[model samples]
Target: MILNGCAIVFDDEKYFSLSGDNVQCDQRYYITNPLTTQFHVKYKKKKEFSPKLLVLMTMSSKDVFDIYVHKGEQ
Candidate 1:
């Protein structure tokens, strides 16, 4: 991705080196975390449980993905 005569770099941590034509560049970092969620549903007579999900791209936006129910230890 180039914007206003500038090259954007993207390396997924498995590369030998950059291609030719390198003369100074800017560095950027991005994080990737795989989150897990568990949900339970009981269906009868061909019925299913579906939940609504939303995705936001703004920095000041927030959304809830799932809710957890914990059990007490005996």
Candidate 2:
């Protein structure tokens, strides 16, 4: 999955991808502004669920990004 100019990979294979100005993910509607470096996820009203997973990415000096997954609240 890619978010805010960052690419992420997960073992589960359930991931979101950027489609134009929108972020496509299961059970959520996330919109992204390309001009900004921050993005967030908004859940659907009927299918609302808490975000139990937090993904963090840091950009390295070599221009590569590293992804880290943390369970529970940050």
* Over 4 Å off, model 1: 1-61
Winning candidate number (TM-score): 2
Error of 1 at 69 (Å): 0.6
Residue lDDT tens for model 1, 1-74: 33665544432222122232222452322335324322222212321332223322222123323333333222
Lowest lDDT 10-mer window, candidate 2?
12-21
TM-score of each: 0.17, 0.25
Model-by-model lDDT, in order? Answer: 0.29, 0.44
lDDT of 2 by residue, 1-74 (tens): 33666645433313232222233454444356645534343322332334455566665434555577665431
Best by lDDT: 2
